[model samples]
Target: MGETNVKLASINPDAQKARDLLRIVIVGHVDHGKSTLVGRLFHDTGSLPDGKYESIKAMCERRGVPFEYAFLMDALQAERDQGITIDTSQIWFKTEARDYTIIDAPGHKEFLKNMITGAAQSDAALLIIDAAEGVREQSRRHGYLLHLMGVRQVAVAVNKMDLVGYEQEQFDLIEEEYRDYLRSIGVEPTFVIPVSAREGDNIANGSKSMPWYKGPTVVKALDSFLPNAPLVDQALRFPVQDVYKFDQRRIIAGRIESGRLKVGDTLMFSPSNKTAKVQTIESWSAREDFTPPSEAAAGQSVGITLDEQIFVERGELISHVEEAPIETEVFKARLFWLGHEPLTAGKSYKLKLGTFDTPVTVQKVDRIIDTSDLSNSESEQVERNQVAEVTIRSRRMLALDEFTSNGRTGRFVLVDKYDIAGGGIISMEGYADQRAMIMATKSTNITRVEHGVSIEERARRNGHKGGVLWFTGLSGAGKSTLAVALEKLLFEKGYNSYVLDGDNVRHGLNANLGFSPEDRAENIRRVGETAALFQRAGMLAITSFISPYRSDRDRARAAAGDGFHEIYVKADVETCKQRDPKGLYKKAIAGEIKEFTGISAPYEEPDSPNLVIDTAETPLEECLETLVNYVERNFRV
Candidate 1:
């Protein structure tokens, strides 16, 4: 030690109450001395319980093994036996400046899940690197994981300096390499210092071994980190945990994850699109005569009563109407997978966000990321411990925020069967929020007029029932080809039918619409409404368009109701491009066309379609016969 060691202070109860507490997780490659560092910090600060150190030394003596600092932190029998940490261990620590909770996270590759659990709860991180080994692959992986988990404040400790003769050159090399790696992932390390944990050098005091080095000790670096500010300024994200009834009063109970709310504030619950005003903010206090709280903010578990009774359930997000979360069935995610089975596209899993739970399918595995090198590669499935960027689709709309906007409501976990298999943060780079669009109906004075002629009478006059044959797929998947043939055959069979091709409709009904997502949605809205009217008129409205989004098609289904039939025109992108019926695919691939489905843009496959026409393998005549038989069998009334 560089300075005279003062007598260690005992943990003062009075000081603990007034001081801010910070949770710091120590992580790195296995055998990088994370445990030894933790053990030394306790001994240097004199925070260990009386007789706990002596007992641990005695246990090592009885076992006929040399005493090591790592034994102090590896308290579990399994850990001591294996000489490796397998789970997370939380212990209290204190510096002269603040009270601290030290979370010792496992650094082994197989115990990555335990590491993630620890990191997710931490406010900052202390990453250890073995000087002799320098930056290993696991070190890079840990850095990426920390970034993925949103741990921004980081300090790097180049431990085992004694093994390398406390050389400044070696420490500097490791620091520079690892620093560049962290910065590549958008993490700027606050400090990087060389220390010997076992010798108690540069931990609580300055290091005498390295006279040329001048920096704050590990304790000083930790004390300098500030606590995260309260989330009062962010948008409201109150996820309903449960609903309770007492004396004919229904109270919505949940933890306010962000923002503040007062009585009389209007709240909009999402996925249901219902609204209510907060009548009372209920909180339990020790005093019996305590009146309800006038307001509540983030980190408070509260119950609120609404001014009106409405149907609400767990997992509904509550927000102010003006700044509500995005409601969409699909969104992009960057996730770290920990499942035993590979995460493949088209596979379904249960997603848990806040209290919201819904079944979601992996629509596309965009790319597999190599964390150690930060390289990307295309893969159909993401293996265990692999990170991937993927598109996830839920059958129903979910209310969520972008992780950058609000982390508490944007992060989620994936459950496979019964186990949590993966976790991720949400991003909406190219996708729309859809909250405003979904709730944009402004009609106030309109009436639906029932026709005098019954549906049965119309069906009898047309010689068949009516329907909207919705054809959806990629651009060159033979939708127009099959739809027109089906319409002609149905007409020859004495059934009233019409073909609404994409180009033909765009030239007239949707002439005003552009190719933007919002315009495309509006175009589909108009087409769905028109097709439904045609269905009501006892005619088969055959629609052919590259309706790529599942949500858009679902809206069309809702408009047409039971008379809607979704026909999937199936063809792989490569096959469709090879056919190049209209040369659109060539233009899309050549960058002449923007936002082209199956090329530059996305094409969502239907989860379940009424019928599938495989144009690549099936002949045109056979495909036509399948269509004709389906219409004749179902439409004949």
Candidate 2:
């Protein structure tokens, strides 16, 4: 029972597996008694390892220090003497209502990242204010932080009541000041109860010392915290972590961030645009006799074997075919800067959102908010511990959702050098984030590119409507073949058209790019923008790429403006392998190539396409006729 180096209490398996488990984090300023409150909760709930409490008490006695509940949180005697938690720690505690995992977050401003790490993973938070100290700067800062991290349910614990002689007046004053600041930031506390974490008064049970108080005890208040809204109701967002090829079975392992996934479900990977059907629902110890789960919902780490082995890699987001996340590079975010240096505009930092890690720059400092006093104003740069609204421009397009849409996938961190310097929740698309590129285009246009040619003018001049014919599907799915043959048909028929074949375009235009998720996004972006320019000049830009990610295809459609048609060249894996004109699927199957689409990587089919040509079934002449006829009826006179 005497567990040493215990991060979590050994709880009953039944309690551990309960669906009512809630993750609550204790956060506040240094020496404000966050650890002590949590330690008291654990000890009172009978959650501590046997003799662990007594050992801490004995150590405090031998060192001539008073035995405090806070002592149980600090591993080293020096840490307790210093009266500050240096790192984040988690402890398991159960109550009459539900089980809890209380995260102890350090309160020191320097350890802000540690606190943020804890707060980010939490469902709710208990913000502590030292009654004796009477509303310090860190108290206001932490409270404001909890709001930014989207911890909606916060209760203020007016700790150290014994030091204030258990006076109700002292508790009232501190609660009033903190409550006003919290209101300014749009947060209302659930409760502001006075407590002495050291003496364990008003903790598990109500305090008799404060006879005027008639509210719930610490335990009662904590038990009132509601369980988080289940992510099953939302759209799916599973970012691939790693692909495991153990023996002959290739399993894509990841946690479902939102929605549910079932066997035989069709999944589309974003930014890569790869498609696969769930062949099997796999767990770590899954066997032939394994009873498949009905469906793996949000928060479950699962390994899924696809019907077709499409090269899915880390950074690609798996989504439902009907619904997909947005893909963009420029977005607005509300971030709290924790870097030692100020977050200055024009400086590049690595922005990690889900599996997408790309170098990003602070294009504009919209404004900065000082959490210390809730004072906000427009600023040129964001300093340490200051929250700010800024425009971020990533090096490549990233699949993303608004924080309000999905917190797990919607938040990102800014890495300066090697350390994670800032964290933020994406607010919305920063259309202004494209300012730098726009200004550059303006500056470099010796020919003075103009938007004088209207859509109608372009269409009339082209003889056929000017637009993009975007062929998307797996490699060797006849996308390039169809696009080339279609271009030949249109050319001989005396209409302005050109084929931007994936291979030929890559050789010249995207020679610097590779097949990674980031590179693929950039490659598509360039092709899309280039196709748009060609379309504007009244030419039908027929572009063919695997373009497996829906989000990327959507972005390409966006760039091409109106009349961008998506064509799905349908072919199953076996058919595509048999027609492996490039010998890529064979190499990928043999493990000679990594992240190769249609074999190891994913090829997401168009969720809804203008046309679906079964290349495996239809003859080349018939496929050509169907494709050309559709284009003529839709785009021709």
Whose lDDT is greatest here? Answer: 1
The clash count for each model shown is 0, 16
**Candidate 1 backbone collisions, by pair:** none
lDDT of 2 by residue, 75-169 (tens): 76567657779888888888879888888899999998888888888988888888899888888878877888888898889998999899988
Off by over 4 Å in 2: 1-19, 76-78, 285-294, 429-637
Candidate 2 vs. true structure, TM-score: 0.67
lDDT (C-alpha, whole model) for all candidates = 0.88, 0.81
In candidate 2, clashing pairs total: 16
lDDT of 1: 0.88
Error of 2 at 184 (Å): 1.4
Q: lDDT of model 1 at residue 138?
A: 89
Q: Give the Cα error of residue 5 in candidate 2, in Å.
A: 22
Error of 1 at 361 (Å): 4.0
